[model samples]
Target: MRRPVESAQYTSGQYARFARDHGVRLSVGRKGQCWDNAVAESFFATIKTELLDRQSWPTKALAHKAIFEYVEGWYNTRRRHSSLGYLSPAAYEATQETATERAVA
Candidate 1:
């Protein structure tokens, strides 16, 4: 017997096939699970608050450039995060790398 495919299921299946074919890993989360992407959600909120809310961008390219600089130059390198005990992402990564090296030695 042939079962009917719902539109949402069919769309998701097609996307999953596309992702698999392209070697892209898609994040899986339950329909109502908020915490599954809590980190990403928090990051988005922070970026919106720290960058996007402060100014108006005339073009997408300008916005993209600004966001790139903010993330690479400011956020990762200089901004202190509360979750990481006030260490910048670069500093936290350095500490983590050091710990890994110590563990391997």
Candidate 2:
């Protein structure tokens, strides 16, 4: 079942507000862009396999904390991704920043 359009719009608007407050550049692409969704699907799949499927959470609060720790502690800082030249997300981002700074200089 699909969500009501009004509810979807409300959620999207809330996300846009949150993104703006966080200085996030939201990627608005034309419809039918498989590439845009693929990355997120891959991440969700990996997280499901690694964290969600491994154990059960007694409480939503605990689950949220675990998810936060998994992403921040291990996934971003240490997990090597093939698409990122086998570098962790944090390392890849750092390199990208350095490259951008050098190009600007």
Candidate 3:
């Protein structure tokens, strides 16, 4: 027999509260709208391919540490993201700052 799981992780109440607190609009994806989640899926796929798939974790603590290092140390600061014009997230942010300053001056 197959076990059934909750379809959504967040409840309407929780989502409504979050949206109210954050001042952002939130909407549930309509059925069969897979493209709505494509970017998030792509990010996770990259993370798994670049970091998680390579490591063998013996414990939850080890896995958490590895994930933290990959996300904070390597992925955020060092890895070049093609979506961000082949720059790391940090570098892209820095370039944006320079461009903003140039625009102001």
Candidate 4:
């Protein structure tokens, strides 16, 4: 399950009960600020649009495997991000690694 993002509504007492019941930690953004969760929200939106919305799975295991493959195989290695100058995340990381090595040398 995803982490809870709403504030105030989920007090410490509520979070404790939720955590105990679900065995998952609940996280909240700082008071009145919503940007803290934007990155995760954006990621889920992307995955839903590109992966989840396009397919159906007969089983949970199949769905999990498909998600794993979509993230590692396509999203990390092939999908381009405008923020990264249209480079795939793996490409951006490789370029960063190369720059670091050159600086070290």
Please provide TM-scores, in order, for all candidate models, with all chains considered together: 0.75, 0.70, 0.63, 0.65
Assess each prediction's global lDDT (C-alpha) against the native: 0.86, 0.87, 0.81, 0.84
Compute the lDDT for candidate 2. Answer: 0.87
Mark the 10 consecutive residues where model 2 has the least summed lDDT.
3-12
Clashing residue pairs in candidate 1, if any?
A: none
Q: Write the per-residue lDDT of candidate 2 for residues 1-105, one digit (tens) a residue.
A: 975453444237687798889999778554446687677889999999999999999999999999999999999999999889999999999999999999999
Q: Regarding lDDT, does 3 or 4 come out ahead?
A: 4
Which model is ahead, 2 or 3, in terms of lDDT? 2
lDDT of 4 by residue, 1-105 (tens): 998765565555677687779887666655667776875787799999988889787899998999999999998899998778899999999999999999999
Residue 54 CA displacement from its true place in model 1, Å:
1.5
Candidate 3 residue-wise lDDT, 7-98, digit = tens: 66443556668887999775557545677678678789998998789978889999999889888999889988877999999999999999
Candidate 1 vs candidate 2: which has greater TM-score? 1
Off by over 4 Å in 3: 1-24, 27-36
- Root-mean-square deviation of each candidate, in angstroms? 3.4, 5.9, 6.5, 6.9
Stretches of model 1 off by over 4 angstroms after superposition: 1-11
Give the candidates in order of TM-score, highest first: 1, 2, 4, 3
